[model samples]
Target: MSSNDSDSWGAVASSYVQVERLTTPPCQTLVNRVSLLLPLNVPNTIAFDNGCGTGVLSAVLRQQYPRLPLLATDASHGMVNILRRRIEHRKWDEVRTRVVDSRNLEGIQDGSFTHVFSTFMVCLAPEPDKIVGEMQRVMKPGGVLGLAVWGDPQFGPFSTPWEKACRRLVPDYEAPMVMDAKWTFAASVEAGLVEAGFKDVVVWEEDVPWRWDDVEAVSKYYLEGNNPGNVGMIDAFKARGGDVEEVRPIFEGIIKEDCGQKDGSIELHAPATLATARK
Candidate 1:
């Protein structure tokens, strides 16, 4: 794939605007990560959530820390609108929504926040190092920065099959911007924190098992969920003499077989690494 093909992620933001992850109630994974790092009760500090997709995590954080000021941002106007609507109807207070790029929080002031958070976004950033620097810059010296990113693909049940299909479609396709769990082990997070003048970094992880009542349903949802990103992927498949429409059913069937269980539930592990560092 050419370098230009990589810039097609805007579709992801647009397509996932009304997705289930944001509309559903808080999940165990969300609760556990925040519970682990946050104090017994919510604090009265200013907080920021980068890539606040549909404001799911941001909503949960606001609930957990009602006394804190929250700023939720995304690179998508659609997502920002959805978040604003959701919050307005619920009357959540002191929470601002904006279409701010994570790579540089220029509109946000330096040392102005007591907490910073991001989920499943840092890895997708074009410049992760710059994003970390921005996070550090916007946080106070003793502030806590909490973030979560993709773990091992083998354990990320939803992503593994999707990634496999993408690879099969474009063998040479390499994701230069995607961050993986290995980044933490290789000091990518630690080094970035240090370079950004962060301190006392602590990282932890947990696996969230996502279960669907049927393999077919899970596979179908997965395909439908990620169909927006398939523009480039489908183009790659066609360029390789692959009939994407014809192959989609086969790919979906393969995913079902790969994830099926005898008890009528298809299970996949969605693991996330949680990290906290001080600025």
Candidate 2:
């Protein structure tokens, strides 16, 4: 990952920790499905949670398999610190935290883990192919690899407003590519896993609905906190001489108009893909 990407994540680490509290249900569902698919009951089971932001999935795995040894890694040191803190607070000695890049995985030994999983992190990979290769490299011969990533943004109702707002407010504005190099599509994700020497690769779609009591809550968490692409869009607009704060009202108006308030709340469907394969 680039320094800019790392810096951006570092700046948002605290906010992301808070956002995950609200956004973890879908991720937890993915984690459960992945765990069910793996032969985790085998003797001497060891696991890895790559790109473990705030350790939500790690916590779930720990609860499900208390005896399993888990190593959680993230590219951002700030995220790693938060994960470590969470682990320490929970007194989970079985789980270890590390600051490591997803693509390189510098210090991890080959064929060291029985299962490897990453949630919502593949989208940020600078080179997703390299990351997939590393995940395969670090897992044992029969190990399971699972991942989740954002599906089409068009189906994401909460995201559409920010996307439309960026286009209208900033001239010639192009949204930053979060999942570059064909990693966004299900076919490509499956192909990447296969190329990395994984077997029985299965990629499937899931729709996770996120509900907020009010637009203010939506603006605070989804817009300003969870969605990094929206934040990047605002930054890009500002860079092009646009006043983002000054245009806040207009942006909110567009969102309310597009997403239609119902019963004093807003519901958004966040579509994602969950993939699992054996190495």
Candidate 3:
């Protein structure tokens, strides 16, 4: 990812963390499953949480393995600040936060981590292979690496509407390209891990549901919030001579109508893929 992309995420660290906490079941699932898969009680175990936005997975991992050393890193300095604050508030002395790109984990020695994990990070990379290579490089032989990513956005509840809205508004717009085709499916993810020299790879897909009590809340997250994806959509809309203020209502209306509103709330099922492998 570019510095600008990291900066965009940094700008919305607070809101992004809030919304992700409520909406990202796949992330929680990755943490739970990886905890079960890895030998947390192993002596001298150290873990890396790459792209550790706001330290959500790091916090959970700390609770799971109180004595385990945790290093959380992100490209966004703003995200690292939130993570540092979280660590300070919780007094997790074993947990450390750093601002670093997942693609090039500078100053981190090879095979230094016994367990490496990332959630919703690899897919966002401009080059998923570089991130995977770094993850594999840092992981000790026989160590496990786990990651979660969005499945096909066409089948996703929240992403599909926005995708459709953008296409409708912008005549020449195309959905953002996937960093790796394998990132969108469980089997492909497994194959990619194997290709990266990981063994005993396991992958699965799930539909995680997110609920919002108000349409405006959804609008605020996608529009008002400093979400990089939405910001790009707004840019595309303007590039096509569409006014953001005018297009937002139309976009919200499409989302409300298509995303299945019930009892004054919107329920969205986000299709996600989770994968783990031993290096």
Candidate 4:
């Protein structure tokens, strides 16, 4: 991650609670899958959380294995800042926090950890292969490496209705390619891990019914989340001469119509792939 990337990530750290709330279940699922593949060796196993935004993955790690020690790191200083506070408040003494880019984990020596997990963040790295290499370098010879990335359908993180609004409002609006396309493929993920010297790699698909009880709240987040993506979206709408304020209602109306569930919650398909291997 570059300095600019750090700045952009930090800017969104506060609002990321929303993202975290929406993602925690999948975080739990990924950690649970890792635990099944590589049972922890108490007092011996040390884990690394690469690109641990707001410590969402770290929290799941702690919940699933309360005694496990962790070192959570991210390239964004802002993310590290918020995570530090969370650690202090949550009283997670076994977990340590650091600000380090996943692609270049300097000062972290080779074969330092028993297990390393990268949840959803590897895809955001500018050089994902380099990040995987760094992860492999720091992990013990038989250490487990678990990873998660969005799969299949495009824009799992964004509502499809939003895409519709963009295309209708801005004739040439193309969704930003935030995640590397190649990384989204299960084969690409397994191949990358194998090339990084990991063995027994396995990749599998998972999906969750992502739900929101309130349409207004979801629309509010889209309007005010201030994440780099949301900011860029509003900018695109304005740049294309659309009524900027109309975007929120468009998101709400379309989502309610398309994804609203029977229990009065909006549901969307959130597909992701998880991979596990030995280093």
Highest lDDT: give the candidate number: 4
TM-score of 2: 0.89
TM match of model 3 to true structure:
0.90
lDDT string, candidate 2, 1-279, tens digits: 776676668778887754475447766776677778876656888989998887778877877777788999988888888888888888898888888878899989999998898887776568888888899999999888878877763334544676576667675765555455356668887887888899999898777776667777777664567356666656766777777666666667776776546676766667777788997
Q: Give candidate 1 misplaced runs (Cα > 4 Å).
A: 1-44, 152-187, 222-235
Model 2: which residue pairs collide? Answer: none
Whole-model lDDT values for every prediction: 0.63, 0.75, 0.78, 0.80
Q: Model 1, residue 273: what's the lDDT?
A: 64
In candidate 1, what are the lDDT values of residues 116-212, reduced to their tens digit?
Answer: 8777666645677777778888887777877766554233354456546656666654322234444433256566567778787766666655667
- Give me the displacement of residue 1 in model 2, in angstroms: 2.2
What is the full ranking by TM-score, best candidate first? 4, 3, 2, 1
Candidate 3 clashing pairs, residues 3+ apart or interchain = none
* lDDT score for residue 47 of model 1: 77
What does the lDDT come to for candidate 2?
Answer: 0.75
Model 2 misplaced regions, further than 4 Å: 21-23, 153-159, 167-174, 221-228
Question: lDDT score, residue 264, model 4?
Answer: 72
Model 3 Cα RMSD, 1 decimal:
2.3
